[model samples]
Target: MNKRKIEVCLTPVLLPLYDIENSIVVVIDIFRATSSICYGIANGAEAIIPVAKVEDCLNYQQTDCLLAAERDGKVVEGFDFGNSPFAYTEDKVKGKTIVLTTTNGTYAISESRKTAYQVIVGSFLNLDAICNYLQKQDKDVLLLCAGWKNKFNLEDTLFAGAVVTQMGLDNFEYDDSAYAAEDLYLQAKDDLSGYTSKASHGKRMQKLNLEKDIAFCLNHNLTNVIPVLVGDKLVKM
Candidate 1:
C-alpha cells in the first residue's frame, strides 16, 4: 500500500503552494483561537461560526449567538469576549452558538474552507484526538498554521510539530517542512511553555498580561472534541 503524505504549511500565506483539494487540512492556531474552539466545543457549545472580519461577526449581534472578536491580542470593543479559552466555560457557552473573529485563525479557516477536502480546527488542547482521527482517515494531511497576521509564528509551528511527532513518520511520507517541525517539537517537548516563552506572539501575550491564557493554550489532551467545518460553522465531530 502507498503511504499517505503529510505536509506542513508554516503560514496561511503559503497555503496556495499545497494541494489541499485532496488533503485533510488541519487548521492550527495554538496561541488562542483554535484552542478556544476546542475548549468551547468540548464544554458543550453547539457550534462556532468563524468569520474573517469583525464586521462580519457584528452582523450576528441581533441573533442569539455569542459574539467574540479579538484583534492584536485584545478583545475588540463591544464584543462579549476574546479568543481566550477561559472565556469558554461550560456555564456560559453550553448549548450556545458563538460567532468568533480573530486576527489570524478565522481568516485562515475562511481562506481554506472553499478548497480543502476537509477543514478541521486543531490545537494542543486536542492533540491526541487529532492524531488518532488522522490515523484512521487514510487521507493525505496538511497541517495549516494560522500564523500571526499571515506571517510565521512560533507557537503554531510548535503545535504543528507536536502533531507531526504524535502522528509518527512510519506510515506517512513527509515534506521537508514536516521534518523540520518534528525536529523542533522533539527539542521542545519536555518544556513547551518554557520554550514558547521566547516566541513573538508569546511575548506579545505577555505584554498584554496573558501569561495564564498562554499556559492554558499549551496544555495537551484536554479535550476530545474535534471542531470540523460544516458549511459556515464549526461543529464538534
Candidate 2:
C-alpha cells in the first residue's frame, strides 16, 4: 500500500472537530463555487479572494475587483455575480481580480484555511490538476467538501472520491469516510452527470432553473489550473 493517507471531509460542519493541521486540504464545491473559481482563473482572473460572508466581499468590492456573492444557492442582493460557472465568462472575469462569497464553498475555504498546512481549491473542472498535485505533495490529504449548507451532499463527496481514486487507488489505506466516498464515486463513474442529477443539491439547483450548470460542473479535466492559496488569495499554480 502507498504510505500517503487521504481523508475526505464529507461536510464542512465537521471541519472544526478534525485535526487537519500540517495536512493538505483540498476544498471541493463542485456544484458551483470551486468550479467557478477554476473558470475564473482559467479564463484569466489574476486571483480570487474567497470570503465567507457577503459583507466581507462587499468590503473588497471598493478596491476595483469584481464581486460574486451567493446565499442559499442564489445571487446575493447587489453583487456582480452569483456562484455560477457560466457567469464567470472570459468577457467578465478575465484579467481581473475577483472577490467571491458563496453560501457553503467560500465558508468552507475560510474555515479550512485556519489550520491546513496548504489549501488548494478542487472541482471537476480541474480534477486532473488536483490529482497530479496531490501525487507530489506527499502529505496527508483532507478533501474538504463544501456540502450544501454544511450538510452532506453527494456531488462534493463524489469529487473527493475521484481525487482519492486517482491519486493512488487501493494502494493507500484510508478512513471509512474515504472508503465510502470512493464507493460512491465508483458506482457513478460511468455516468457522473446522470448520477448527480438525483442529488438533493442537484434538485435544489434545478428548482433555481440552473439545469445547465449541473452538467457543466460535472465536466472533467477541462482545465489544468490548480488554485493554491497564496497569502489569503487563490492563484493558479
Candidate 3:
C-alpha cells in the first residue's frame, strides 16, 4: 500500500510553499464560511458559488441567487445575507443558488481551484465526512486553513488538528505543522466548543452578537454535506 501523507497549512499564505498539484486539499473556515456552506447545502440550497471578492458576487445578482457577502466580520451593504450560519435556514435557503464571498474562506477555495487534485470544504459540521472521504482517497492530504486575512488564526488551525486527529491514519506521514495541530486538538477535544469559544475569532464573533452562529459552527458532525469543487461552484457529493 502506498503511504499517505497528511499535512496542515496554517494559513492560505503557505499554500504556494506546498506542492499540492495532485493532493486532496481540505479547505477549512470553521468560524463561518465553510460552516455556512454546510448549513446552506443541508437546507436544500441548489449550489454555492464562492467568489474571492464582493465585485465577483455582483454578477450573480442578475439571477435569483442569494448573495452572502462579508468583509472583516460585517455583512457588506446590499448583500442578501452575511456569513452567519443561522442565516441559512431551511425556509430561506431552500431551493436557491447562493453566491458567497468572504474575507478568507472564499479566497482559499479560489486558491485551491487549479492546483489541487480535489477540493473539499471542511467544518465541524461535516468533520466526519471529510475524514472518511480522505481516508478512502489514500492520497496526500493537505488541510488548508482559511485564516483571517491570510494570517494564522486559532480556530482554523484547531480545525486542522481536529482533521489530523480524526483521520487517525497509522501509515500517514505528517510534518511539524500537522504535529502541532494534532496536539492542539488532543488537548481540546474533550470540550471543543468551550475551548474554541475563547479564541480570537470567537471573541470577534461574540462581540457581534453571533453566539448562536459560533455554537453552530463548533458542533461536530451536524451534517454530512461535503461540498466539493465542481468547476466553479461547490456541490454536494
Task: Output the TM-score of candidate 1.
Answer: 0.99
How well does each candidate superpose onto the true structure, as a TM-score?
A: 0.99, 0.96, 0.96
Per-residue lDDT of model 3, residues 9-109, tens digit only: 99998899998877999999998999999878888888999999999999887898899999988899998887888888899988888999999999999
lDDT at 166, model 2 = 89
Candidates' C-alpha lDDT: 0.94, 0.88, 0.89
Evaluation by lDDT, superior candidate among 1 and 2: 1
State which candidate has the highest TM-score. Answer: 1
Tens-digit per-residue lDDT, 5-104, candidate 2: 7888889888886788868999999989999999889898999999988888878856889988988889988888897999888898888999999889
Question: Residue 126, candidate 2: how far off, in angstroms?
Answer: 0.9
Instruction: Quote the positional error of residue 213 for candidate 3 in Å.
Output: 0.8
Comparing 1 and 3 by lDDT, which wins?
1
The local distance difference test score of model 3 is 0.89
Question: Considering summed lDDT, which 10 consecutive residues are worst modelled in model 1?
Answer: 162-171
Cα displacement (angstroms), candidate 2, residue 161, comes to 0.9
